[model samples]
Structure formats: structure tokens, C-alpha cells
Target: MIGFYGDIVFETSNSRILTFSELQRSTASRWAKHEVIGKKPTSEFIGPDLDTVSFTVNLNGQYGVHPRDEMNRWLIKARSGTAETFVIGNKRIGVDKWVVKSVSQMWGVILNKGEVVTGKVDIELEEYVERL
Candidate 1:
């Protein structure tokens, strides 16, 4: 069944709530793979490598929230070394731990009388683990 979903919010350990205005994409890669031996295929060889999770999140079209400068500050603050989690459908699903890889600003600046009206952010995160 096709299920309609809402905006996914990712919460950092420092408690920054990022509400996406337009989420471009998100990806998760599995770890294990099957290998072929000399004659036959071998079983799946899994390592301690954590799954990678990456996505671009937008912060435009939001009202009554923090201003553009404040949003920018939060983006910078997210880079601190801490574990983050995901919030899908407003439910606290904190199973996956993430760390911010990068945060670049997506250019869609609406202007009102030569002043910035709204802004957006494009961020990338990677699933985190302490050791391999």
C-alpha cells in the first residue's frame, strides 16, 4: 500500500529541530554482501561497518520559527561531536545514531525590498558508530 508521509525531522543531541521545507533526497546503504568462493557462492559476509545515511533537508517556507540568521547558527552548531537521531511521523525513533557530515546552504532566497525573506539549508549526515 502507498502510504502518505509527513516531513521527517532529524534531532541532534543538542536538540536542534530541523523542519524540512523541501527534502531533496535521502539514502541508506546496507553493509553485508555475498562473495563467490572458488567453486560456489559464499554466505553473506557482514562487518561492523555501519549503514550510511545521507540526505538534503530544506528550511524554507517556515513561519514563526527562528529567523534566517538563527537557522544558520543552528546549522553551524550541528557540527559538534555528538550523536543524533531521526524523527519520522513525529515519533521518536532514536534507533539510528547520526553525525553531521556537512551543511551547505541551498540558494533559494526570496527577497522583499532587497532583504532576505526566506532561506533554506542543505545538510548531509552520516550514520555514526564509535568503532568498526
Candidate 2:
């Protein structure tokens, strides 16, 4: 079986590709320094397991392999009152702000010779923001 997680793509003017995991690590590093202190850090996990922190992908859209010469870019949109946006890179570069027009859910499927498998994903941005 295949699994999916938060995946972001970044396109730089200088021709660079940035993945979501790379961006999250960078952001977490910066937050670890100033915000967290002493034994209990500000960014420390607060759930059943320390490893299961609420980390998410903040990508603008779907991504796939593209032919050369395409101007691929990474952009993110959030509401005005959103606080402490956890961007993968420097917010100034990684995100392009826009009003959220709508939110929706998506699913995927796979089929074999005699069987079909389906997967579902539901993301609620409002719920995540509330936790933050």
C-alpha cells in the first residue's frame, strides 16, 4: 500500500525545486530556537506520542512530473486573521497570500484485475487553525 503526507513544491526564480518536508524542517528549526526554551519546548508534541505532532502540508495545488521549461512555483493561501502560519520556508518567499474561496475533500482509487481499492482524505483547515 502507498501512503501520502503533506507534500509541497517550491519553484524559485533561479531554478530550484523545494519539497514540503524540506520546508517543514527549516521552519521547525527556526521555531525551536526563539520560541522554545528549557526542558519543555514550545514546539514539543502534546499528544499520546511525542512523534505524532500536528504537522501538515500547506501547498497551493497538486503537483506532478512536468516537462522541462515549465515555470513551476510554490504558493500558499491563508486567511487574514490566521496566526503563526507554519510555512516550509521563509514566509516571504514560500507563500503567496490569497483569500480562501472554498475548502473541499478529495479521494483516490486504485484497481487490480479483480479488485478495487479506494482511499479517502479529509482536511479541515478550520479545525487545525483552532488548535493552533
Against the unseen true structure, what C-alpha lDDT does each candidate score? 0.49, 0.27
**What lDDT would candidate 2 get against the real structure?**
0.27
Top candidate when judged by TM-score against the true structure: 1
Per-residue lDDT over 1-132 for candidate 2, one digit per residue giving the tens place of the 0 to 100 score: 012223323343333322322111122212232354456535644343111122222222223322111111111323333323233344422233222222232223333552213222222222122332
Clashing pairs in 1: none
**Could you tell me which 10 consecutive residues in candidate 2 have the lowest summed lDDT?**
66-75
| Index of the highest-lDDT prediction | 1
Model 1: lDDT to the true structure: 0.49
What TM-score do all the candidates reach, one by one?
0.51, 0.18
Q: What tens-digit string does per-residue lDDT give for candidate 1 at 62-113?
A: 4433446645654654656565665555453334666666667644665765
